[model samples]
Target: MNTNKELEYCNVAVWFDRSTLHAMMQALVEAGLNVAWKESQKQFRVTVYTQHGTSDLTLLRLNGAYKLDELDYCVRDMRLALVLYQFIEQAKGHAIVKMMNQDKIVVKNIRYGEAVRIVEIKGAEKKVIYEKACSVTMDQVIAALKRRDAEERIPVMRLELDYELATLYDAIQAKDTAQVKKSKDRLKQLRQEMLLLEA
Candidate 1:
């Protein structure tokens, strides 16, 4: 808890899931912040240089939580941290929109029919039927948006399970115990989550 903000670093941690954490890191990187992922520590080190001084922030993940560390608590550093937080919030919104769009699929099912009598439709027609059957009213839409806003939301990362499994295999072949263990745990968790999502 160094209060001296000038030319110093401070660290804080905020709770975030893997995707939100990754989005924040990506946003910091896009904003020209020097960011590095410390794999061993499961944290991100962010350094920002200004004309007056240098500031740093570290994001650590632990027990499915996240925390941010700032180098200093000076006005400048506080301002920078605020900006970073805003950027993260913006990124989170973007991620939510992306996830919603990706998950929004045209429901294709028979309205009323047996196996012998059915119709397959997609796109606008499917949407119409779905909206009618589900009674997706304005209140529901509002409620859904509220739920999304309140949730710790993140877009699905591009990283695929197959790629992660392959990396795990490589780690095993290389006899990298730490990596093998990490990858195996991640793959197991991710696979379970994916199955749940699919269900």
Candidate 2:
């Protein structure tokens, strides 16, 4: 195992290091993701759990030979997949993460002594997100800072939405027409603002 470097935002912590097949699994567990693996008859059975759901997998060894296709695993939940993709930074030398309705974060294990390209894709649209090495460019640093900011803000915004929905539910049950109307209006405004953030 090599020394690991950490990057964190609130409750999310991602570590980067030269990773082996087994090391990736450990990294997942260290990130507070639930993971269990065992070997039987020389085959590895692994299970990963997230707030969304669970994913079970079988692998040959701890070698970087398998690719996780989202459709092949959990079709409705991507939290597990995203968590696994972060570990690929060390396994594949680099990895790219496409955050939902957000910009992509690129992680490279090896520095190329020059700028690395980062691209963003949505539907049929593609654009360059950043090109300079983060250590040498203020633009890259600013972008990273913005992403970190979003990481913190998004969860709070979601909590606000949840609270409003719960209040609205209680008002409806109580037959409070005025409160219901107010709650609905507040929910609409919050949703619109959240949509803007996603955009």
Candidate 3:
């Protein structure tokens, strides 16, 4: 109900189920914040206790729509904003992870080039969000998918090397001599490729 201009805080309007919104509030409560939901106004009043002082925030919710003001308590409050942001992100991430695990979403393809990389993700709605890879590797993509945190990116070469190393370990554990040999050779080659890229 509050306008962005009036709030003057980083915030987002999201439509989600009541259960999902409750889960986010639970996360904040678990992090040592006092939260109370007011049915009359359909808002949540949150009190954050810090070493310096206590801060308060009001999260407006109606039906499935919700808005959380990041800088509600303090102007330009990076620390408080980060804490709330991380909680919201983690909640959203978990939901995405569940969807991916259930096959509701899928990664269509990944194309890598000299200067850029492209990742294509397809959801149940048939909508796709194309992400440009900025040093993002396949391994990081896999990790992000599993964790539901797509914003975390790392170098492609490093990811490839780590994957090969992991494969080598797995082969060793399985006592598959052929696989171990193959993984070792692949890892060696990856290392050389990484060196060339770095140079």
Candidate 4:
């Protein structure tokens, strides 16, 4: 493997499978670049035909461990490096999409056992907008469970509102003015707390 001095301090590791490489080729093609490849049982030889010149990359499987000099290639040429970086990032289940108004959206999907966690971020500041956890079969959008303690509070607060509403209902039955007002105020506070969790 060729070594790059500039990238010596950076430890970049990537695990390449057959489907991942094929998806990478598709990404390059979608980016309006000509790509050709030959794949064997344990190796892949990829060539990118560009206006500047033809760049070649070889991926080899060594004793069940795949190795390649990605940083060296990046140091030599940038066009193919960018595509490879994007493809590897996507394969790792991370993506960032830029919006028209200069805001960006980042999505990360992770799996643990049978559950999948999805996280969505919006805007340039990369604020966490939404997060949830769902089974593999139940797929809309979700996020990791580690930070779900905050979201879990929302349901509890909602349940509290339900109990308070019942109290308010009893207050109305007896026509108690002070109890009804207190319940209403408590319900409003619970609703505001839930909204803050979403924010």
- Judging by lDDT against the true structure, name the best candidate: 4
- Number of clashes in every candidate structure? 18, 0, 0, 3
Model 2, CA-based lDDT: 0.49
Candidate 3 residue spans exceeding 4 A from truth: 1-16, 69-83, 90-199
Model 4, residue 80: C-alpha shift (Å): 2.7
- 104-192, model 3: which lDDT tens digit per residue? 43332211112122223345356445544354466644544565322122134445666888988998999999999998888766644
lDDT of 2 by residue, 53-80 (tens): 6767655422223323222232123444
What's the CA error at residue 93 for candidate 3, in Å? 10
| Winner by TM-score between candidate 4 and candidate 3 | 4
TM-score of each: 0.31, 0.36, 0.32, 0.36
Off by over 4 Å in 1: 1-13, 69-72, 75-79, 87-199
Q: Sorted on lDDT, highest at the top, how do the candidates line up?
A: 4, 2, 3, 1
Model 4 agreement with the true structure over 1-199: per-residue lDDT tens digits: 1222111102233445556667777877877779998877777788888755787767776444343434233223344545765654543322222212224333333211111233334443555554564222212123323346753454355457669989999999999999999999998766545434433
Q: After superposition, how far is residue 116 of candidate 1 from its true place, in Å?
A: 59
Q: Model 1: how far is 175 from its true place, Å?
A: 53
